[model samples]
Target: MSTPDNNWEDHWRETLADHKASPPSTMDWGGMEELLEAKVAPLSPIKAPISSLEGKTLKLPGLPWPVWAIAIALVLALGYWLGSHTALGVSQEMNTIPKKTSLADALTPPADTIFDTLFSVGANGELTEEIISIERAIVNRTTAQKSPEINTSLPAGKSPSPSTPVNLNREKLKAGSNDIAPSTTPAVLLSEAKAPTTSPEFFTGIRRPDTPSSAPGLSYDLSSKPTVRPNRGGYVRPLKTLSPPTDRELLEQRIKALSLSEKLVITPLRYKNGHFPAYRPRN
Candidate 1:
């Protein structure tokens, strides 16, 4: 607004310096530059761009190819094991087998107390003591009858009078003794009691006779041809033409495979006296 005069430049600079604020922490140019250069980033050799791993031969510092393969295989195996555990989960066992509950066990009423058992109930919903008195009387009668002193002393007199005595014949006493009662029985009674009561029912067990047997056997479709080959000719077949196996035969073959492959211990044939000489292969 005014012309340059009276050395105003130096005064303006002094006034701005007096009013100007100090640098803030974030805006400190010297500190920021120091930090950027020393602490934040240090200049080094420029690294080359990393190449793709697909085509390159992977050279792990010391580990061999099989080690990597083993590691991968272990990882895969672990993954498979984990996957299988997750997929199948734990096997359900019959740990809690269903208890066979009977109708008697399920529907039965709880056992009653002695008071409930003996007491009499009227239709008018009143509890009567009549049943209690009757029970008490029965108990008293039982107690009285069981006592020996009361029973023995009931009739008073120790000896019977001549008028009350009853006489027994000595001959009748000897003839009717306990051990030898002498009852008559026929000999044929035993055989008649043991005779078989049944006639016969067909289809009993695995072997049925053409003519009916005294005891029946098991049943099958007897009309069908035999699956088992008990041959008319002897066992004279070529090695190649050996019978085509059934599934059961295959299972038997699978079972025998372990034994067939197994080599017997090469033991020399020993006799009672000495070692026996080797026989001819054809024999």
Candidate 2:
């Protein structure tokens, strides 16, 4: 119960004072194990692990992934088919427009027998929006189609295939060349033509056909000339003259015709400093 550490220095010091050193304590292995076992007790047994959850109704609300995928696929396929069918029909209808005919027949005047035709827009005929739209579409489409046909109808743009050598069907080219340009040039307008003058031979001796006389307020001479007489003074003819450079004396008469502008262009160059001043050549 009372144990102490043994030191040789304490024994030597205490020997002079007549005191004895205590011996070192020793442990017994068997006795210590006996004391430990006496203090401990055995533990209780462990319970079994949980087996199953408490029972209740379970609801798994869901569509399977495969089913959802099939539904989406069906909807997309249906839309594709409907869109393709509609597009095909539209293309066919677009290709079915009537071909162009000669402009003469198309532009011919409608019969005036009908009241609508008589009141219609002049010799140029009536133009509606629908007609112009259809005409422009036809021209644009035909031009695109013509390029391909020209390429195929004869090896157009081919480097003269060595095997076939583009036997340039000359007869076809010559025959078609006739149709290339328009057959008729469109009408150009000259100044309006004067009405034919009455022939003197046709009226040599016959009485004039109720022609108006210069004087008014007189009786008619139906027996011979058949001149028309009305109540008015006779008209007098005035003399007309243009101060322009007239047709005959255009060059000689400079002062009469030349304006300040004309005097500039046609004025003769005068030599001032022997070098004709600084006239820039018409650049």
Candidate 3:
């Protein structure tokens, strides 16, 4: 009896013998030869066309040098004109803006006058007296100049002395006063003239005779002083101290207490033993 290895070797030899005894394939070679000839036939003609194109140079129509120069000059002139126009417009805008006057310049008096010099009066009486004296001097001088009769009436030896008060008739004084133009007074003088109230400092520490000692409904006893409790230094300790569980510990506890139904609900859809839903076509 032959072993199983001898049986396998005999079967392989018979298969090899059958393969060697098979006849050669009868496929046609004429079509393949024709295809190869067609592919090689156009190679020589392609080089001839490529070489002919290399020798000739293509010429494009172009503007003359003078025409190009004229175009560049025109562009430069236009750019220069635009730049100058923009600069001129900017300068005109700047010129149109009114110059701002400084605060000090605006507040300052234009010319030094008598009122400007007398601005340092401490008391209202002195300021008023000085203003009145100046007004009287101006009135007298103006009246005397207009009335040539007053000057003629004075003796030739004495021109009117500035110290001597000119006593003119009341009617003449009134008429001359009307003719005299109103002078511009300082703002300080005008404000003081309108309202001559006493300063707040004048009323300091003075109590009114009719004022009540205390408010109508409110009173406090000053005879006795209230006692203050002493402060304890340290903070008070709480009766109970609680430390809440961490997120990880809580999660572990929750996992330990999970029910079968909850586990099934939490399980991934792919892991669950059920057929997937059928695909539905959209309407």
Candidate 4:
């Protein structure tokens, strides 16, 4: 008698042989065609009604057209009148100018009795008898101080006294009057000529120093001193660079980098010059 395992193996061999001979007639799939057609058919779309406002005329309230037209006309007329008058006014103001006159002529004294009573003719109005006497006294005192000569004439001058009669010369008075008049008016001589050397009397109160002040904390040494600067030096670290890899490490790195990916590849035409081709997938 044979074992059950052997029997089962023999049964499977027979089944496989029968299948290879006729192949089980191919399954009947014609019944599923109706289900596929039903799934493929699309549904009809829903329709909506159009709005009532379409194809209709727009409505608005009535307005007064005549009033607006009159207001626009009035504004245009006023602007035209104002523009014409402004140009005419400016031209008239610029064309009619007044003449110029001298200030000296306006300030001159009038030849009437009113002006004559207020202002007299030459030095008479400016200086009275008393003022003249005062000026003469000042001039005499200055002359006496400058010149020490006596003013008496007596053969050999027996003696001069306060009671002696002094003669006043007209030439001296004329020269003094000319000098005083010019001095009161302006410094005309100072502008025309250089000033003379001042007398010793003018510098009587001023004095010069013989030596510099030697007071404590009052002087400073102006000489320059030499500066000593520090000399700085230090060491700088160099930058690091990569060394070449060993043969074993290089092989291991290449093997670890192996990979697969989907990419696009193109084929060039052998006959075309600049027109190659479009891209295609290399799958």
Q: List the residue pairs that clash in candidate 3.
A: none
Off by over 4 Å in 2: 1-61, 99-105, 108-283
Question: Which digits, one per residue and each the tens of the lDDT, describe model 3 over residues 1-283?
Answer: 5678699888888888787644543444566667788897655544655677786887755989999899999999999999999999999999999665885454443332233122211112111112112112121121121111111234444533222333332222212223432222222233224321333333232221111111111111111221211122333322222212322233345434432212322445555576655667899
Tens-digit lDDT track of model 4 for 174-207:
1233335433321222211322133323422211
Task: Assess the local accuracy of residue 265 in candidate 2 as a C-alpha lDDT between 0 and 100.
Answer: 22
- Which of the numbered candidates is closest to the native, going by highest TM-score? 3
In candidate 2, position 65 carries an lDDT of 91
Compared with the true structure, all predictions reach lDDT values of: 0.34, 0.32, 0.36, 0.32
Clash list (residue pairs), candidate 2: none
lDDT of 3 at 255: 38
TM-score, prediction 4: 0.19
Pitting candidate 2 against candidate 4, the one with the higher TM-score is 4
**Candidate 1 residue runs with Cα over 4 Å from true position:** 1-18, 21-59, 90-283
lDDT of 4 at 2: 60
Pairs that clash in candidate 1: 205-217, 205-218, 206-218
- Note the residue pairs that clash in candidate 4: none
Candidate number with the higher TM-score (3 or 4)? 3
Give the per-residue lDDT of model 2 (tens digit) for 175-252. 112243221201100000111133322322222222211111111222332222222233222222311122113222
Q: Give a tens-digit lDDT track for model 1, residues 225-276.
A: 3233232233323232322222223334543553443323334456524667
